[model samples]
Target: MSDPVQLATARELAAAGSVRDTLLVGQRGGYAVRFKIGAGERTLVTKSGSPRLFTGIDAAARVLGGLGIARYRVDSSGLAEEDLPRRRRPDRAVALKRTHENAAYLEFLQQRAEAGRRDTVRYTDEQVNERMRTLRTGRRA
Candidate 1:
């Protein structure tokens, strides 16, 4: 059915002010509704001037549909995943391109590191050995 007519029907079914509240009130995950009953999750839906406990949103929807209060019924057990369009996997060409890009970046970093080490100041053999020992042990030689 059309959106506007369907929304109006849903609002009347839930006794809510707006369409958003109607959907919120009809929390269909477990098919349960949160209408004002007492003070908790349990809510009362009046039928024929008598207050009745609505067991599930599906049942409420059925009653509303039977009474022409709702334009359509929602399937509680339907998988939302089925409604989504299938996603295409990236081909081998794209995967290989990404790997090549990563390898090139690593080679650039390696070259920069080697250049940094080569540009470092040179010291005497004995001083170099002492510096290496200090660096390896993280302490004075």
Candidate 2:
């Protein structure tokens, strides 16, 4: 394995028609591109030196098309769909339900408040205070 080729360098080689025998190899969860430049086969790598991975074949094809690579062989022998990592979010559904429930309760409270404001009968602060005094002493205040 020669030194991995950076994406920019791969693009340059691809544009210049120096890249050959391009292959799209499928991994457990993604696809990677490998191609021959001169006599050495190189894998495309990111700036951090990790093989650049595309989560889907469509994305990989779009990128390859942008790099002027019109043709490539696909090998899906390594792609085990069942072996791909599954992301579990059991709490997410509960949290979303709680959020919606809370929103509905708040809307109910707001509607009740608006209905209270629209009532024909209203009480002033003094009347409310006198009513409280009468209720406390069992007599008119």
Best by the TM-score measure: 2
User: On residues 4-109, what C-alpha lDDT tens digit does candidate 2 reach at each position?
Assistant: 9887898899988899788888886678889988888999888999888877678788988989988889998999887455668989989999999999999999
Give, for candidate 1, the lowest lDDT window spanning 10 residues.
19-28
Model 1 agreement with the true structure over 1-141: per-residue lDDT tens digits = 111233234346456423222221323233333322223222223334223323455666665555344543334454343443344667877999999999999999999999989986877999999978889898644
lDDT of each: 0.47, 0.86
Cα deviation at 69, candidate 2, in Å, is 1.0
For each candidate, give its TM-score against the true structure: 0.23, 0.59
Q: For candidate 1, list the clashing residue pairs, or say none.
A: 31-57
Q: Give candidate 1's whole-model lDDT.
A: 0.47
The pairs that clash in candidate 2 are none
Q: Candidate 2: where are CA atoms >4 Å away? A: 85-141
